[model samples]
Target: MDAMMMDAMSKDMMSMPGMESMDMDAMQACMDACSACEQACTVCSTQMMDCAPACMNCADMCNTMMRSMMRMQGMTPAAMMAMLDACIAMCQVCMDMCMAHADESPVCKMCAQACQACMDACMAMKATMATA
Candidate 1:
C-alpha cells in the first residue's frame, strides 16, 4: 500500500525539475525517520534532562523536514537539499546531547538512536538528489 502511494507521489513529482530521478524509496525512508525522530525527541524532552532544549528543537526540525518532503509541489532540489542539511545538523546536535546521558536515561538512548537514523536517511536522500 505504501509502495503504491509512493508510486503515485513519484508520478506527481515527475513534472518538477530535478525530481524526475528522485528515488521515492529514499524519500519515504527519510520521512519515516524524521517522524520517528520527532516522536522520540518529544518523549525524551519530557524527561526533564539537559537535552530537553535540543530535543524540542530537533523535533520541530524533523517535523518541518518531513512536511517539506510530503509537500514538494513547489520545492526545488536546492531548497530540499538545504532543508536536509539543516535536519542533519539538528539531528547531530540532538544526538550528541542525548548520548551524553544515554547511559542513565533510556529515553535519551532511544532519542539518540532515532536521531542517528534520521541523519542517515536525510543523508541518503541528499545523495540521491545530488545525483539527480
Candidate 2:
C-alpha cells in the first residue's frame, strides 16, 4: 500500500478498539511479504510438481491475508490474529512441500524462501497485534 493510503487507514483505524495503536511498519512488512509469497507460490504452482497444490493453496491464503490487512474496518483483533495464524500455517506447509524438492528446482527454492519470509512477517504481525 502507499503512504497516503496508510495515513488514511491510520486515521480510520485509530478508532478501532484493539487496533488503535497498530504498528503500521509491521503491517507494511507483512503485506509486502504476503504479496511476494503469493507471486512466488503462483509461479511455483505452475511447475507441475508435487508441491503445486500446496503452492496454490498458499498463494490464495496469502492473498486473502493481505487483503484482510488492507481492509481492517470492522475487523476484530481476534479475527486478525486468526488470519495471521492461518497465513503462517499455510506458508509453513507450502515451504515444507517446496523444500522437499528445492534442490532440484530453483523455483521451488525461491518459493520456499518466500514462504519462510511470509511466515516470519505474519509472526511479527501477530506479535505486534498481541501487544497493540
Candidate 3:
C-alpha cells in the first residue's frame, strides 16, 4: 500500500482501544512482509516437496496476521501479540522445512528467505508494541 493509504489506516486505528501508541511504519512493514511471505509460500507449496504443507500453513497464517493488523478495531493488544507470535512460529517452521531442500530447489530457497524476512518483521512489530 502507499504511504497515504497507510497513514489513513493508521489514523483510523488510532481510535481503537489499544492503538493509541501504535507505530504505523512498523505495522506497514510487517504487513508488507506478511504479504510477500504469503506469496512466496503459495508458490513454494505448489512444488510438491516435504515443506509444501508447512508453506501452505505459513501462508494462511501470514495472510490472517496481515488482515488482523489492518482491522485493529477488532484486536486487543494481547491478541495482536499472540498472533504475531503465531506468525513467527509458523514462519520459523516453514523456513526450517524449506532450508532442508534449499540446495535443490530455488523456490524453496526463496521461500525460506521470505519466511525469515516475515519473522524479522513480526519481531520488529512486537518490539515496537512492547515500548508502546
Between prediction 2 and prediction 3, which has the larger TM-score?
3
lDDT of each candidate versus the true structure? 0.90, 0.90, 0.92
What ordering of candidates by TM-score runs from best to worst?
3, 2, 1
Report the number of the highest-TM-score candidate. 3
RMSD of each: 1.8, 1.6, 1.3
Query: Whole-model lDDT, candidate 2?
Result: 0.90
* Model 3: per-residue Cα lDDT over 13-99, one tens digit each: 643476576887898899999999999999999999999999999999999999998888889899999999999999999999999
Kindly report which residue stretches of model 3 are placed more than 4 angstroms away from their true locations once superposed: none
TM per candidate comes to 0.92, 0.92, 0.95
lDDT of 2 by residue, 35-110 (tens): 9999999999999999999999999999999988877786788898888989999999999999999999999999
lDDT of 2 at 127: 86
Q: What is the lDDT of residue 99 in candidate 1?
A: 100
Q: Candidate 1 or 3, higher lDDT? A: 3
Regions of candidate 1 where Cα sits further than 4 Å from its true position: 7-10
